[model samples]
Target chain A: MKMLRNLLCSAALASLTATGAMADGHGWSLKKAAAPYAGTTVDVVFLLRPGYEAIEAMLPAFEEETGININIIKHPYENALGEQVRDFVAGGDLDIALIDLVWIGNFAENDWILPLADVQAKYPDAVDPKLDMDDFFPLVLNAFGGWNDTVYGLPFDNYSGLMFYNRCMLEEAGFDGPPATWQELKDVYGPALTKNGKYAFALQSKRNETQSADSFARVLWPFGGSFLDANFKSNLNSAESQAGLKFRQDLMQYMPDGIVAFDHAETVNGFSQGDIAIITEWSAFYSSVVSPDTSKVADCVEIAPEPMGPAGRKPALGGFSLAVASQADEAEQAAAYLFIQWATSKANAREYLERGGVPARQSVYEGDDLEAFKFVPALVESWQDGVPEFRPRFAEWPEITEIVQEWGTKMMLGDVTTEEGATEIGTRMESVLEEAGYYSGEKPLAQ
Target chain B: MRGQVSRKTIFAFVGPAVIGLAAVGIAPLIYAVWTSLHFYNLTKLKKVKFIGFENYSTVLTDEVFWQAMGRTFFLLVTALPLQIILGMSIALVLHQPGLTLIKTLCRLSLVLPMATTYAVVGLLGQVMFNQKFGVMNQLLGGADINWIGDPENAFAMIVFWDVWQWTPFVALVLLAGLTMVPGEVEEAARLETKSKWTVLRYVQMPFLLPGLVAVLILRTADTLKLFDMVFTLTRGGPGSSTEFISLMIQRVGFRGFDQGLASAQAIILLIITIILAQIYIRVFYKEV
Candidate 1:
C-alpha cells in the first residue's frame, strides 16, 4: 500500500513530463485538441457556487476558441451529487462528471468516469502537451482526481479551510489579529469576542455535509484524531477526537444560538453581516464574503490559515475534479476532456483565479508575485502539509457522513454525551467498512 | 354460442383496465418487492444478489428507522387533531348567516397558505425561523431563541407548519360539508333549542362526517409520505429530531445508495399506512 501510494504521489508530476516539449498556442491549444470536435457538445453539472460561476463565465470564450459547446446543467451544491449519480447510473447524456474529493472512490471504482490513461489512449492527438499533473498541488490532485494509482480528473475548484475573521471585531475585543491556535481562540479571543448576543466563531453544523466535513472532520484532524484507525476500525472514540469534540462543546457558549442548524450559507452570512468574529470556511467562498455587494463587513474580513492544535494545522480539505464521463460517446468524451483541460490548464489558471476560483495550479499561485489574493499565501501554507484523507475517500463515506451528521448534532444539542456520540458513530462506521470487505483480506487500507 | 359471445365481450371490456392497473401499479410494487429481497446498492452493483429478508430485518431493527417512525407518528397524531379542530371551528363560524362580504373575503384568505407550494413553505420556514435574522426572532424583540437548532422546538415548528398550511384546506372541506346541511332542519333545531351548540352537535355534525372522514384519510396518508416541505425546512435535522419516515427512506435510498433497505422500509411503512387507514375508517367513518 505504501509503494502504491508512493507511485500515486510520483504520478502527480506526470504532467510535468511535457513542460519543455510544446507546440504553439500557449504550449497546448484548444485549437489542436478540440478543433475536430468543433460542433460537439459536452454536458456537465455546474454547481451554483462561485467556483462554478467563474468557470461558467469562461464558457463563452471556450466556445469561441475551440467551438466545443459546453452545455452546463446548473444544480445547487446539495443536489449536485444526486444529479451526478443519477446521470452516471442511467448512462444519461452527461459528458463530464464532477467528482467531489470523497466521491473519487465511488466513481472510479464503479468505472463511471474514464481514467486519464484511457482518455490519452483513445485521443492522443487531442490530449494536451502541457496538461501536467505536477502543475497542480499534489494534495488537491490526489484527493480530487487520483484513486488506486490512476488519474480520472483534473482539479478544477480545490479548497483548503481557512479562518475568515473580522479584523475590526478582533481589534474591538483588544486583539490585533486572529488567534494563532485553537487554544488561543478558546482561552483568549473567545471570551472577548463573544458578547451582547454575538459569537467568536461560527461552524456550519447543519445536518448534511456541512456537519460532516465542516463541523465534524474539521475538528477531528487538528486534535490528532481521525474517523478511522490504522486498521479501518472506528477511531472516532479516541481520546484526541473526544478532546476536540469536548473543546467544541465547551466553546458553544461563545457561539450564536442555534448554531447546530447553521449551514455554510448561514455561517458565512453571519460573518459577512458582522454578527460573528470568525468563520472557518472553504477558500472557494472567498469571493462571496469579500465582495462589497454581498458582505456588510467586507473591509473588515481577514484571511488566515486555520488555527493550530496539538496535531498541528490540518485544515479541512474539500473540492471537486472535472472528468470525462465514461458513458459519453467517444467523440463526446474527447470533447469533454478538451473542455476540462482548457478550463484547468496552467495557461488559464490566472484567469480562473481572477474569476473567484481557488485554482489548484502551483504556477498560478506563483504568478501572483505581488500576493494580491489574500488567501493565496494561506492556501499555500495549509496545502503544504494538509490532510489528504481529511474525510475518508471511500464509497461508504456518504453513509458514514450521514451517521456523523446525526450523532454529531445530537452531541452538540446535549442530547448525547461526546462519548456516546463517538461510540455510536464508530460502531456504525465499522459496520459500513466491514460490509465493504475492509475487515477481510479483500480490501487494502487505501490510506 | 351465446355463452362464448358473452365471455369474449367480458374479456374485451375488463382486459384493458386490468392491464393498465398491472402496468402502472402492480408491476412497480412487485419490482420493489424483488429489489427489497436483494443486496442492491447502486454503488456496489457487482455485489448485488438475493439476500431475502435480510434488508427487512435490518430496517426493522435499525434505530434510525424506529426514531423516524416515532417522529412521523408524533407529527400525525399532533398535527391532525389540531388541523381538524381548528378547521371545524372556522367552518362553523363561517356557516352562520349575515356578513356575506366579510365571510367571502375570509374564505379567500384561508386558501392562501394552501395555494403556496410546499417547497416554498419549507424555504419560508427556514428564513422566518432563522436564529439571528429570522422574522420570528425579530418579532419577539430580537430574542436569541434557538428555534430550529433545539430538537423539541424544531419538531414543534414542523408541526406548526403542517397545521398552519393544511388547516385551511380542512376548513374548506368542512365548509363544503356544512353547506350541505338542510336549511329547514337547521331552522327547526334552532327553533326547538335556543342553543347553537345543540344545533351544531345534532343537525350539522351528521353532515360533516363524510368530509371529516375524507380529511382524516387524506391527511393521514399525506403525513405518512410528507417529504418536500420538511426536506426543504429542516431536512430531518438537529439529530433526526424532525425526521419523518419518508425522509428516513430517502436517506437510506439516496444518501446510502442502498435500494434494498430503502425498499424494505417503504414496504413496512406501506403496511403501517394501510392499517392506519383501516383503523380510521372503522372508528371515525360512519354510514351517515
Candidate 2:
C-alpha cells in the first residue's frame, strides 16, 4: 500500500510538471496549475458594471476549467466603496475586491490589499511569463494597477472620457461632425443644437464624487488646470481653472433647466432620451448609448475624443482594478490571483471586449479587426491622451472631493461665484491636507 | 421570603434584556464618547490621539455643520406640524362612526406609503419630481418646476416626501387616542355645547392632546435623523440646501473618515434630541 501511494504521488508531480511545460508553450492555462486548489471558492466583491457583467458571464467557463467556484458579490457604483470599507473593517470573507482608482492609496496605505509583486514572488508559477504584462497601456497599468511604486492589482474596465453626440442632431443642426473645441461647443453647436425645445449639452453636476472628481476634473485638466500643483498645493483658484469654471457656467445656459441635480444616470438618460445633443461622458457609457433597450437614439449616437481647451485635449481617465485581499488565506489568494490573470490575459481580451468589456491591453486596441467595434478608434484616441492624475488618488481625496462637490454645486446653483467657490475649495482642501500631515512634512504627498 | 423570591424572579426575567441594552447601546455610546475625545481618522488610524473638546470646537465653528443643523430643524418644524395636522384631519374623518369598509380601505391606503422602504420612496421621488420628464411636471401642465434643482424647492420636496410617508403613522396613533376618548364624554360635551366644533375644541382636542404630543415626539425624533431619503433623492444637494444633521454626521464619519468629528457631532445631536424630548415630556405629560 505504501509503495502504491508513493507511485501515485510521483505520477501527480509528473502531471503537474507536464502541465507547467504545456502552459509555458501555449501562453497560459489555469486547469492544470489550479488542480490543488480545485475546490477552493473565492468570494469577490465588485461594482456592477458592463465589464464586470461580461466577466461574470465568462465565470462559468473558468469554473469548469479550474474547478474553482467564484462567488461574485456585486454592488452599485455609489455604494461599492462604502461596502468595501465596511467589509475590510469587519474582516469579512473577501478573497478579492474591485477597488476604485481613488481608493488605491487608502487600500495600499492601510495594508488592506496584498501587493501583487509579493504574490507573484510567492506563487511564481501562478504567473504566466508569456502573458506579457507590458501589453497593458502603461498609463493605465501604472495609474489604476499600482500604488506607491508597488503593483497591487490588474486593470479592469479602464475608461476615458469621450464626447458622445447625437449624429442626427448634429446633421440637423447643419454640422458635419461633433465640435472639436469647447469654444465651438459653446459658440457654434450650443445654439445650433438647441432646437425644438431640446437642450444642447448635459453634464453630471450632482453634488457627489462623480461630479467633483470625474466630471469636473475632466474639464479642469483640459483648461491647463489641475487639483494640485507640483508642490501638492491647491491650484484650483488659478486663472486657468477659473476660466474653465467660467466656461462651464457659460455652457450651462444651453443645458437642461435643472442641470444642477443631474447625475451620471440623469445625464446619460437625457442623452439616451434625445433630450440632450452632446455629452462628455465616460467611454464605458458607450454600451448604454448603443443598447436599443436603454436608448432612444442608439443608432444616432457617435463618440469622439472630448472637445479641446486652449491648452490641449485631456479627457478624464477613470476605472477600477481587481485586487486580491490581504486578509484572504494563501490558497484563496492564489485562486483570486489566477482569476485576475485569466480575466485580464491577452487571450481573453477580444472575448472580453465582445462581451461588453473595455480591454486594457494595447494589442486589443491595435487589432486589425477593431473596425467591428465602432467606438474603439475614438476610445483609443481618448485613452492615448487621457490624464490619469486629473483627480488626485490620495487617501484624503474623498474628503477633498466632498469640498469640491459642495462648492462646485453652490457655484453652479448661482449661490456662489466661481471665484468664491474656487477660494473655498482651495482653503478647505489645504486645511484637510494639512490635518492629514501633507503640508506639515509629517507624511509625504501621495504619488 | 416572598419579597426576596419575587425580586429574584424579576431579575431572572429581565437579565437578558438588561445585558443586551448594555452591550448594544451603552457600550457603543461609551465608545463613541471616548472616540469623540480623540483625533481618530480611519484612513490615518495610526495617528489617533486624545484631543479633548477639539472635535467639538471644530464642529461648532463649522459653517456647514451649522447649516445642516438649521436645515434639520427647519424640516422638523415644517414637516412635524404638517404631518400632525394632516394626520389629525384623516383620523377625525376615519373616527366618524359609519362607513366601516371605506374607513378600513382608506386607512390601508394611507398606510401604504409608510409600508414602502424610504430608499424606494426616494427613488420614486427622483423620477416623479424630475423637472423635465417627471410625472409632477406632466401633472402640472409641464411647467418645468425644477423641484430638486432649486434650493427652496428641494427643501420643500423633502418635507413633502416625509409628510407623504409618515402622515399615516401619525394618523393611526391619533386614531387610537380618539378611540380611547370615551363616547359618553364626547356625547356629554355635545349635549352641553349643541355644536360639533365646540365639542371638538373643548372635549375631543383635550382628550387627544396626549396623543398629539406623542406623535410630535416620535415625528420630531424621526425627522431629525432623516438620512436615507435625502441620501437617495437629493443627496443633500442643490448646494447642501437640504443637508440635515444626520446626513452631515454620516458625511463626516464615513465620507470624511473623521470618526472623532462624527462622534462629536453625534453627541451634540444626541444632547439636543434628549433636551427636546425632555421638554416635550415635561410640557405634555404634565396633564397625563
Q: TM-scores for all candidates?
A: 0.96, 0.94
| Regions more than 4 Å wrong, model 2 | A1-28, B1-6
Model 1 residue runs over 4 Å out of place are A1-28, A368-370, B1-22
The global Cα lDDT (0 to 1) of model 2 is: 0.83
lDDT of 1 by residue, A280-391 (tens): 9999989998899999998988899999999999999989999989999988998998888888989888888888988899988876373558898898998887887899
- Tally clashes: model 1: 2
Q: Give all candidates' CA lDDT scores.
A: 0.87, 0.83
Q: Please provide, for model 2 over A283-331, each residue's C-alpha lDDT reduced to its tens digit, 9 standing for 90 to 100.
A: 7788888899999999999888889999899887888888889888989
lDDT of 2 by residue, B172-240 (tens): 988987888788988777778878788777777777888877887878788888899988899888789
